[model samples]
Target: MNRQVERIFSQIDYLSSAPQADRYGLTKLKALRSEMERHRHEKYGLSEVISWAFRIKHALASQDHSDDWREGISWIGDPDASSVDRTLSYEYMRSDQKLVAGSIWNNYYPWIRRNGWSTIGSVHNSGMGAIATWILAVREVTKDSSQIVLLTTRLYFETRQLLQRLLFGTNVQVIECESDCEFLERIKEPTNSKVVAYLDSAEQSDSLSLFQRISSAPLPKPVVLVGWDNTLIPYWKNPVDSHTKLSAPLFLMRSLHKLDQLGLEVASAGLLTAASPAQLTPERARYLELLLSEVKNSMKVIGSTASPTTIRRLEAFRLPNADLAQDSNQAATAASDRFHDSISGVLPKYMEAVSYPHKVFVTIPLPGTNQESISKVMDQIVKQCTLSGLPVMRSPSVGYEFTSISSFLSESDTGDATRFLRVSPGGHDTDMIDEISQCFLSTVSNL
Candidate 1:
């Protein structure tokens, strides 16, 4: 049996062993089906679905003949499969051919559901994460070719430009609105341009008039209002005040920085090298170190260890922070303990003891949670990694909210919380960074 086919058969067996009625089982199957269909449709770049079809067929065959099932399964081996083997397993086919050949549509069907664009809440000194979030938000709102108007703070002019470059390229027209009145003039144009207003710098200034203008205008398309900085629109403030004035539906994202900055540093880690977990090996660690050394000074890596002891181990190798230290002596003594121990303590058991070839896994809570709170913590890690020039592999497990589960077995049989992992490599490939960052950020920015 082909090794790839054997692997699929293995997964089918693994999944089939579960009770058919299990929600998780169904979800896993659905996920697999979705992936297969995506590949078949060419929505995803690779055409691995052909091999997947073979695997599924082989699995069906095994199920049909018990003797072949056992004997065929027994033939599976090759623990460390080569990349070439994986890639060559599938040949390119036309999209229609792929769908038919891969047995898609028959089993898996996906649809487009209209989800409103996300609103970003905070835009302080926070860096790449904010920009990445904005880019994703822009991408979603502009999908139908809507025009976005940026209301930036003079203090954050550099940040604004940086964000524009990263998200929409340097040529993107960003009107720096100094006040509500100026924003009014730009939108007054008679053209039927789709309108998106951003409020980054003028959090303290009243947007009531601006909101009124938007509400009063017969917008040719949907209008989206994105605001950052909670202080601008305090929770105690009247939501009706803005809603009464605004013409379009109002969507607000609290804890803007955290909500906006998903997958910010994923690219700094590495690319998708393998579909399987990256084994932690000493040589891989050396390679990671090399990768870390190449990160720009402005960027940083944050490694979360499940074990606090491993954090201490990391601290042992930590370089001194000159800015935080009063003097060289103070810097050495104080900097060692200055790390937010509260943040470090949450490091999971797997994080601390895991070997080399670290794959960075990060998780985020459901959106509209305390984004600012988490953003502050993450920013620190990014800064530290950037300063140290160390590549931190992201673990997908980072963002899961843990909880205890009750079972029929016993209270003692409690298991860990279900979580998702976001894995990415750390290195200097600009194209890879662009891809990984865009993919990761796109997932959560809608939240």
Candidate 2:
């Protein structure tokens, strides 16, 4: 598998020079996908697959889409690789919509259906932006004053509160769930309530287990998982749609920024993916259609449609591994693990590091009982690293302390934090990560 990964990057350079570059690239990409599916159960192998996918993405992005597709619709080698850069307007955007919809249904959309992602919604790349608009769409479809909109992450509570009041205080009520139990409990008496959860923190590793519970239980409502974190690891099959129970409709609302395997940040990008036809029962299908319809209505009202450049970028950004493009640094596993071992894993008395998934960060307590304590530790680490002459984080995605890891009720969700100290080594290799880990350990142990 490691050889397969190395081979892709090695051969990737030759792709441009080869007689049939697209053919060569496509062949290798398909092979990589096959290997990914084979080793989907192993996390380490998944990391290799992502690195391979990242190389392919880099190669494709580097290639020049020299021809034009402005007047008429056409793509280079891959039909899904639709690329165009021009000023996009309402009419043009509508045309783009038709083109995108047609392409998805005609090409990869059906194929990706097995991967558990289909019915790509309008692209609204920002995390909060996509959530806000999707809420509006849900609002349009439901008049149930009793209908609950469960927001698992406290990060979105304020936004929902403002929208709740601003939109005439309709039947929809927003509830913030501190834990998965709270999320499930709040919606236990479900009429037509839905949930929107953001798996933004690496520390929150227990959400998938919770989803498994939700999938197995006789719950009626559906949950929409945003932020690219959920799909990073494969569970039963597809992280979102591969639920063995297949009880409720599962819709994935992803902030496209989280999709960058190389951890590249797109300033503006948003994608809301629909449920798989395989999992959608007639009742579930009806629910999905109504919500999707409202989502479109919300997007139309807000004028947050994606730009042509954005469309091009999004098309190029999507890798072929069934949207498993959640933000995971292949380096993060080793670096985060090393940081954890040196700090909380070995020494939990003076300092503690919250356990996280394969994400590229490790956090220590800022030393407060409130979730706020779990935040603002980045500043401390930055100061410590600067004082130690260590390199600052190379990754672009980071969070501020308005709400911290302590906000999560489940200790398993957030390892250990009165507050937290997040130290991430984005692309650093073994030697580099060892150095970075030592630097973090010294700074945190001293604190």
Candidate 3:
């Protein structure tokens, strides 16, 4: 093993020896150690290295999953094994609860079901999966060519691109609607075609209002609301990096219920999967149990009540720049406010011409720089930040070049093909953000 890997393991051993070591932190450390061991000789690309670094940082920051380290380690040894080896020894365990079934069901499905809306079906996938599943569900519900309208903002370029790819050969007309009035008018227009509207709440701040409007509107067809609830700022509390919990299933279930109440036949999809049929060795089974337990524990820690009503109440108290501190709610809110203020104070210097739609993201367009030049600058900035122990994701532009909503949004249409640099705080505190800002300013000044 290299010195870096050895150093990480040593830190893990030291942290494990602590009187009250964080279980979650230890579990992540162990996992990272395993990953490093597996990929010791392999070379990692820039993206992979950045991803790994983020995972490591997150693992080191969280606690509460130490009990599952042994099981996780065992499963890591044979992840692809088809069945449990009896001779090797394993215990069978099952839960009617689908762990991957997003936070909506796990958190509030019971309440939602009690309200009269029943789940038709669900798919476990990412945001893209949710969109695809909804499209398929629409096709299944209405066995005729339909007009699919996507109500979304520029922030959801990746999602829009994915939707385009999925609906490429279909007869369905996928129209990207940014204006709420335009969407409402489109849905109101009488046609022989069934209209399926896909609304993304993740990218739009006024998503709840849009949802209310759509749910109340007298539309001829059902609206498939895409659950992008992962973008919620308050839920960014989990310290575990690679194990970011998926809550799309829960959102989908709730959305289905809500739309059903409005007399709409709705279907939903999320990033969580139903329980798999594959059997595991006793060790692996134990590991799986621990993993599920960790997720449940995380939900509790994050205060996920699962009920939409409760969630809405919680949303009322959400601070724009909440920190990852879990001890006292008051302290976290204070920290979050400070975090936001800190970034705001430093960002103006380098990001004078930037556009910030939300507190989490800042986008700056390089006036005269081409994509290649901007990319090089961004690579240097990322390397510097990573070296300084603060890694930020560097996206040249928010979305695909051809499918970019920049022109449609009229935000970055500077005549020249603009290359913009996007930055996020990524759970860092004031000092870290200041340091990063300084590094960014220095890099830009030099460039």
Candidate 4:
């Protein structure tokens, strides 16, 4: 085996020494070791390597089917599978919760019922935020018929450890698959419910089989493919790499585009992607602020006037705002109430009016109101959209406004009016509203 392969196998072997500490370690080692044994002679062959990886993955999976791991460490702290199964029965109440809550619980309770069959693929190593969001989304969407199955694969053991501890009642199926084919098969099973696959990686070619498998399968429910790497999709074929099989990136782009054509809007983190819905860390918020900065710059040239700069500054410089952090549940509740108020008050009039090509950024006026109140409102809205399989992402937050029309025009349009709105929310001519409406109508008429 090559030095890199050897190193990988060695690490896996070391982890196997403490099986309880590294439930996935044996699976990882089996794959690597099997690859080494098979490809010891081939100058150019990784098929054996791939098969070995699959073997180790299968071995680890077998362990999950039994109570052997209970003697080691509980990935999630509910004791046995029965404990997890029993909790779901009581947690998913149908008639009492809100729409978003019902939708989220419906997504997760199925996996919980099936002894946790969800297999989640995280492209980035630091994707705890997204994972956390999934947990919250699942908890809120459970139903009597909910039989959720969820799973995850990560490169870091530490991340898995942290996740097991922080996420309450997460008993999803998890296995380590080092190859693309394995990932495809895990998601290719038959089900009449929602099935999701998260494919985020820079090497799209490696996952070509994944896209093919997904495409071939006759799915009964919605399947979401989460993409993160911008470079994975190759727009045009290059003569040099043409011999390579169809790339995962290109395949995914094509697949998603096709799905979009079929009337399915792919969901993304949207404005609330900073950290998962459950935990928004300062470090993570700052990292997203940087990404949002770039997104804002891209918008300035062609897209809408989504002020990524202002949102980034707000999230980065001022997070866990003291006023907002007093009680997490309460903050979320208040935010929801205020958000409905804002949307009900705005959408009717706002929809009737013309708008510049900018995203709607609502900011709650801050006096006694905490920043979390506004953030929470936006968060709820974004999560709601995500659950319904809609795209509500890469949005920005503008400051508060006296009126919805002004907020819409101010964020999107450029001209004397833009400056006027920003500098004088009150002093602008009252006729500006009429002018704004006419301008918006004229633009839409052309479209």
What are the per-model C-alpha RMSD values against the true structure? 23.6, 8.8, 15.6, 28.1
Q: How many residue pairs clash in each candidate?
A: 24, 9, 12, 27
lDDT of candidate 1 over 1-447, digit per residue (tens): 334344655654333311231331222323433454455332222234323432443353354334432232211221122411321222321111111222211111111011211121121122333333444444444444544444333213334545556556432356666555666666555554444555442222355345445555443332333333222222222323222323333323223111111212111111000010122235333323332232211122221101211111111111111111112122112211222121233344332211111112122222223435334434444444445443333222111111001111101113222222222233222333334334333332433
Give one digit per residue, the lDDT tens place, for model 2 in 1-447: 223434656654443323243454434544544565665533232345545544555444444445543211112223433233221234654233433445431232332466544555456646455666666766665665355454554333335344555456676555545655665565455445554443322344365555555556455544532222243332113344444554444455445454332443423555555554455556556666777777777766766566565555444333323334322333345555655565555544645566555444555554544544333444555665667655453233421100011222223235432444445544434454455566656655554
What ranges in model 3 sit over 4 Å off? Answer: 1-11, 14-125, 136-143, 146-155, 184-192, 201-208, 212-358, 367-372, 386-418, 445-447
Question: Tens digits of per-residue lDDT for model 3 on 236-261?
Answer: 23212232221112233112211111
In model 4, what lDDT does residue 275 have? 16
Model 3: lDDT to the true structure: 0.36
Q: Which structure is stronger by lDDT: 1 or 2? A: 2
Better of 1 and 2 by TM-score: 2
Worst 10 residues of 2 by lDDT: 398-407
Give each model's whole-structure lDDT.
0.29, 0.46, 0.36, 0.28
lDDT of 2 at 380: 57
lDDT of each residue in 1-447, candidate 4, tens digit only: 123333555544433313243343323332433445555433211233333433333333334324443332222122234522322232222111111322222222121223222211211111233343333333333222234444232223333454355444644333434445666656656765433344332121243334334434333232322222111222121212212222111111111111110111111111112112122245333333443343323223322221222122122112212221122122222322333333333333423222111111122222222344434543543454445443232222111111121111111212111111111111112343233323323332232
What range of 10 consecutive residues in model 4 has the weakest lDDT sum?
257-266
Task: Tally clashes: model 2.
Answer: 9
